[model samples]
Target: MGTINELLVNIEQYRLLGYAAVFLLSFLESLAFVGTVVPGALFVVFAGSLAAKGFFDLGDLFWFAAAGAILGDGVSFRLGRRSTIYFSETNRLFKPSRLARGQEFFARYGGASVLFGRFNGLIRAVVPFVAGVAGMAAGRFYLWNVSGAVAWAASHLVAGYLLGTAWRTVEVWTTRFGALLAALVLVILGVYLLKRFFVRRGRLLLAFAGSLLGSVGEAIITNPDVRTFVAAHPRLCAFLAQRFDRQRFAGLPLTLLGVSFLYVLLLLGGVIEDLLASDPIVAVDTRLDNLLFAFREPTMVKLFLWVSQLGRGTIVVAVALTVCGILALWRRQRYILPFLVTLGGSTATALLGKVAFQRPRPAGVAVYREWSYSFPSGHAVIATALYGFVVYLLWRRTAQWGQRLNIFFAGLVLMLALGFSRLYLGVHFLSDVLGGYLLGLLWLIIGVSFAEWRRAEWGPVSAAVPFRSRAAGAVLLVGLLAFFIRTGMRALPAILPANGAAAATVTVPAAAIAEGLSRNRLPPYTESIAGDKQQPLSLVVAAGNEGALTAALRSGGWLPVEPVSFTTVARAAWQALGGGFPPVAPVAPAFWAGRPNDFGFARPLALAGGKPGREEARFWRTPLRTNGAAVYVGVAERIVGYEWGLFPRLGADLDRARDDLVRSLAGSGVVAVSRKIALSPPMTGETLAGTPFFSDGAAWFVEIRP
Candidate 1:
């Protein structure tokens, strides 16, 4: 690596040296035998950083890196193809010892050894040489060798460019930079936690995302009114809709009979159903056959399939819910404590089952549908945790026992909605959803029971019981335990060190890893964000035009951000971050701006009659809906908790009284209707929702036309 770095540096010091040195160094480094002794990592990294700083062109370093790699591998290939006879029976120019070592590894691991060997320092170069001698084709050998070289070069070069070169510049802004980084991290974690907390409290963004995709399916089906206007366009209708007549139910009875038989075998026969290949509950045997038939018509099924992929499970959902709980706590919402209890119980129950089962998935399951490992369904458990706890959380808030009973029953419906989605998508089995519900219910029972018992011991939930001394003691104990572990690990160096006389080489002790790590991480400090940016940054603007706006707000220490994201992010980001849109100002006179429209005029005017607001007061009030999409309204007050619905337009009415309470927020003394407002925009893009999941990919993009 050092030698390679020098070669890169010399290329700029002298043009001829740059070209020649790069070519030769790359060839040797990537070559079969000579690459072993050649050193280049430090040189390439140093050159990469220098290039980033404008001392040399970054492209020069990249070319040298690539040229060196290509030439080296090409030479190795030639050597392998031509020198197989001489090398196999007897070694000449190369040491027989090195080739002897390579043959052993190659034979044991086969083709994979060629790829993985690029990282094994002791035998990387020699293994290729052995591959040559072992009759590997030049084309196949080059493929793996080149792939490894490109990845290897890109990794080091990128690292040097980002961490080494850039970190050096960032080192100067240590104080403020650390503060900003910490604050940003906290804000992100906060947002994530808040979203998760809200989700657990019944704000289902995942559901919304899924619903968006399903709307597409529902759209395609209803667009031409195939069900209604089929007679008008018979040919088009026949193609668009599944024409069901006598054959529509051709195998229906058989399917139900088979399903019943399978269920009986599963529950009563005591047979090992897995061995019998009886797995996965289907509503009917013909379901798969129908699915297959639909799949055969790729265009028709693509939209439905896309919806299922949209429901990709995210820990972010959980994290956001936690953050929401934190906000609820900060606001002292009555629902706060119960929300946390529900989430805590849900998480504990779900995770315990996942660990307990550790069940393997069915073969080709993921390939067919987006299937994760089976256990108690996360959806079911989380749902139960929230809704079951909701009953207790709202116990005292409700005025009547009937109302409580109504809410309890409603909560059950929600849990079913969540639990059923898991099975509807075929991601979980019947038992998985059922087990999840039981697990969640069981945990809920225990939590409620424990809380009931501890209520007297802990005092009222609203009362704050401060304990400074106990907190200090706990913090100190943790610090001491961490220190003890550090000392134990450090002491281990004296007892153990690699001892290998056969490989005559310098041995680095494991203890040295600690020192090396520290040196690598710690950089010289500075106090500026400008000098800190020795290399221009490739800013990743994730928030669309919002990033453009934020970049303008940045101090002179930074420049305009180079956006890397697409347009859709602006919509999502706007929603997630108290999202909003600029006022829809008119191009001309803007009549509504000067004079209130029916929306505003109707509100206050409605107060003039017998009812205070219903008459003239109607001129001042506007209706708002709680659509499932995330929303932010620049209203005079929060409508969710207050002014819930339009009521009798009277000063003495519930809405009018509640309006006085919520008209102001924590920061603002008076809330006013602001121009900027956020509404749950129609969803766009890929998500995990209604349909099914993927066989191989971690994420997927849903295709929908506006």
Candidate 2:
């Protein structure tokens, strides 16, 4: 087991080779027999740290990790399959505790355990061997195996690469950079994993009480009617406002649940501003005097005018908002998170736009307030986005259309109020408000689309982390990461660039920042049968569950073939990349091949009645026909997209075509798809790089078309 710091430094020194090493090491460690002895955590982080220095190819990471993983476990599985267990009785004498723990972890999390355990410190090696010994289905194992390896490799490498290059100072802040690096590794890995699981539930509700209670609370926050109603009901609004500062009121604990939401909101505002800061077209108007003079007659809102000037108020507001966010999380107010995500996404974008475009604000600007750079109004961006998200989280919970309508209208009212507040105060131009609204709403749309896209894939929420002594510490740590990382200057630039011009003028692009977050930030998908024709396709598969999803293809006459890892397929494809002849990777190769990786992952899928699509496999097809037979199997979110040469037919549906297949599986017999590849990047507009592919819970089996 290599220490993380050594890995990081080595990777930094060597660049891409380091990533390849990491990719190979992580995979083998996870797959190798009793290999959990390998230190996966530190290795991955160091790889990431090295990647951050800008020398690695992130795309190849999937294959590298996957290959390493398969090989590692291949040996273990081979050992278990070939070596009798009786001989292992004596092996226990030298069995390290870590190996035992790895076995225990495997037992605990199920097949997914092998996947997750590989990433969680010293457990990587032993679990895969144990899995191999259990004779776990190779396909399923590979699916998870590939996924785990990809995630592990990407996270550590990218983290180290991006943060290492961009914000290495954070490491310097402490004497023990290694310790800091380790802690950072844990946080980065943890946060990315969490984003995939329960958090992607398409914006859940805030249940301060139960894993279930906050469901409705979420509806309240995102619903426009609620916002409107609360706004209209000054008394109620005032009550909430008054209680906002209260951590606890009466018997009900107004705790950290709401705090997280607020924090996200604040970041969103600032982030949006940052996005908008660079664009000269996006800058806020600086002509303060004329703008303020017009508002003189409106005495009703004068008090807030002074508050806006202090900028201190904005800081306070930002703090309060962050506190609200933490409270929301602690309370299991899951619903708020979607809206928060939208807000965060938009604000960040807006800020990026503002700063990137460097669009100066309208000049001869208003005197009411000394304004900073702004193309779109942060107030406006947040108003439509954050409030809209709030409303979205609120209204979706109720079945009542009337309530939904009410909240929708109310959300509109609140948005208008905020928009009016900004305009009346002469703080933002009409265009600024509109641009903010447009951009902010765009974020909401994207967030909502993402939430909806991932809804089916979202699993049950994790049990909430209890707010204990560590809660504060955890928060402080996160804040330190966010703030210092943001503000943290690196010695890299100073060290590399000559003094005057090069250092100050050339800003390193964000894309230059290590893989730009996890390749798995998005969710994954299962096979979609929507486009499959009802033609009886001959499925050549081995027995067991292999026949379960074979549609009408019967195993009675089917030839038995040895199962292989998907990596075999990936390797073949990688090799075939040199060959121009494309391969139609079947949907759910395991359905036909017994193991998940046995045949073309999508090899078995075709219009059964028609001539075989691939000439190579045409000879294998029998004149078999099953009407309305369907097979659908479900898998987890993973990095499982077919590369272009692998699936030439996968045009618009590459990202979503798999889901279409899943839907088409109603009458199908067996659907043995892999949950692997949930963490890999998307190839095209067919899918974005950020999202992963997760399947619906079940792949409905029905006789359907390919």
lDDT string for model 2 (375-451, tens) is: 66777777766667657655654456556656776576556556645654555655566667767776776555445
Q: What is the lDDT of candidate 2?
A: 0.44
The candidate 2 region of ten consecutive residues with least summed lDDT is: 491-500
Model 1 has how many clashing residue pairs?
69
lDDT score of residue 234 within candidate 1 = 82
Which candidate tops lDDT? 2
**Residue 32 in candidate 1, Cα distance off native in Å:** 3.2
Q: Which segments of candidate 1 are over 4 A away from where they belong?
A: 1-16, 84-94, 174-706
C-alpha local distance difference test of each model: 0.41, 0.44
Question: TM-score of model 1 relative to the true fold?
Answer: 0.25
TM-score of model 2 vs. true structure: 0.24
Off by over 4 Å in 2: 1-292, 301-340, 362-367, 459-706
